[model samples]
Every structure is written in C-alpha cells, then in structure tokens.
Target: MIGAFCGSFDPLTLGHVDIIERASRLVDTLYVFVAVNSEKRSMYSLDQRLAWLEAACAGLPNVRCAVQNGLVVDACRKAGARVLFRGIRNGQDCAYEQNMAFMNGYLDPDVETVCLFTKPEYDLYSSSNVRELVKYHQDVAKFVPACVLKTLLEQEEMDENIN
Candidate 1:
C-alpha cells in the first residue's frame, strides 16, 4: 500500500526521520510530502526543505519526497496514496492530528489517516524548537539529521562571514 506523510519540514528533524523510517516499513511506497504554506514564514526555503527530506530518506528505497502546494488529502489523492501517515508526540499533537484526520477523512474518504505515537527519545524534538536553537547558536546535533545539521552549519558560517 502507498502512504503519504505530509509536513512543512522547514528543517527535517531526527524525529521526522524516525517516523519516515517506520512509516516506510509499513507501506510499499511512502511519499514524504513537504507542505509549503506561503503564509507561514520558514527558516529554510522550499527547495532546501525538499533537499533535506530527500537526503534524510536516501536509505529508504520505498520513500519518495515531493512538494505539497495545497491540502494534504489532495496531495495524497494526486499521489494515489491510500494511507496518510502522521506522528503524534504529545496530547496536543494527538488532539490536533485527530481533528486533521477527521477533516482529511471528510475531504477524501479513500485515504485513511494513521497516527503513530513518537518514541520517547524523539518526542521532544520539533522543527520549530530546532530552528530556535539554531537561531540562538545552541547545539542541535541530536535534534536534527546530519544532512540538516550540515546545511544549517554551512548557513551559519556564511551568515557569520557576511556579518
């Protein structure tokens, strides 16, 4: 079965990678949809986000990365995915995902939403937190994937040089 996992992924975190790895195992093909919203300001560009996702999922042959311009259900429909994969880290995430799953179900009944609870080790990791840490010059090696870390470091170096 084909599954779709959608996220803004301004910077791909290890928590996201863990979900992707687990989700890929459950489905024949897992599409990592990078949902881009112009209204929301992101630390990374869409192309950078897509590249990080691709690099993070390089080991998973069944995982593919794609850009999502609109609703997640629409993206799933376009990709012909029957399952929508999501990761829940806490009660807040659970509540939010539950509502989204309900809405996605209403939007596309053919696609089923699957919420996977995040592992304890990665439960605290979030892209927003990681971005904040990076902005403050805090070490985020454990929170993000190597590819994302490398790029972030490079960007920081470039910024430092410019300043």
Candidate 2:
C-alpha cells in the first residue's frame, strides 16, 4: 500500500526522518508530501523543502517527496495514496491530530490517517525549534539531516545576496 506522509517539513529534521523510516517499514511505498501553508511561514520554500527531502532520502528505495498544493486529503487522492501517516509527539499533539483526523475523514472517508508516536529520543525536536536554532546561527547538524543543512546554508547565501 502507498502511504502519504504530509507535513510542512520546513527543514526536514531528524525526527522527521525517524518517522519516515518507521513508516517505510509499514508501507510498500511512501510519498512524502510537503504542503504549503501560508500561515506557518516556513523558512524553506516548497522547492527547497522538496530538494532537502530528496537529498535526505536519496539512497532509500520506495520513498519520494512531492509538493502537494491543497488539502491533505486532496493531496493524498492526487497522489493515489491509500493511507496518511502522521507523527504525534505528545498528548497535546494527539488531541489536535485526533480532531484533524476526524475532519479529514469527514472530507474523504476512503483515506485513513495512521498516527505514529514520535520516538522518545526525538520527542522534543520540532521544526519550530530547528528554525530558532538556524535563526541564531547555531549548528543544527545534529538535529537536522545533511540535506536540510545544505538547503539552509544555501538559503542563507541567497538571503545575503538579496541584502
């Protein structure tokens, strides 16, 4: 079965990698769907996120990233994915995700959401934290994947040039 993992994936943290790796074990093929949400104001653009994702999963088989410009359910349908994979980090996340799952089900009953709890090792890591570290010029090599680090550096160069 094809599973769609949808997220903003601003910097593709290690936590994100862990979730995807676990998801891969459960599905035949996994499509990492990067969504564009204006409200979120991500540091990386859609193209940048996709590039980072591609680099992170470069050697991994049966895993690919794509830009899906719509609701999660619509994106799943467009990608021909049967299940949606989400990584829940804590109780607060669970409550929010449960509501979203129900709403998404209301929109598309055929598409199911499979929530996976984040590994304890990465329970505290999040995109928001990653962004803060990057903003402060802190070394985030440990928290983010290599590809994401490359993209972040490249974006810094672009920003410098624009200035």
TM-score of each: 0.97, 0.91
Where is model 1 more than 4 Å wrong at Cα?
none
lDDT of 2 by residue, 83-120 (tens): 99999999999998999899999999989999999999
Tell me how many residue pairs clash in candidate 2.
0
Global CA lDDT computed for model 2: 0.88
- For TM-score, the strongest prediction is 1
Q: What's the true lDDT of residue 66 in model 2?
A: 89
> Candidate 2: misplaced stretches above 4 Å?
154-163
State model 1's lDDT.
0.93
Task: List clashing residue pairs in candidate 1.
Answer: none
Q: Residue 95 lDDT in model 1?
A: 94
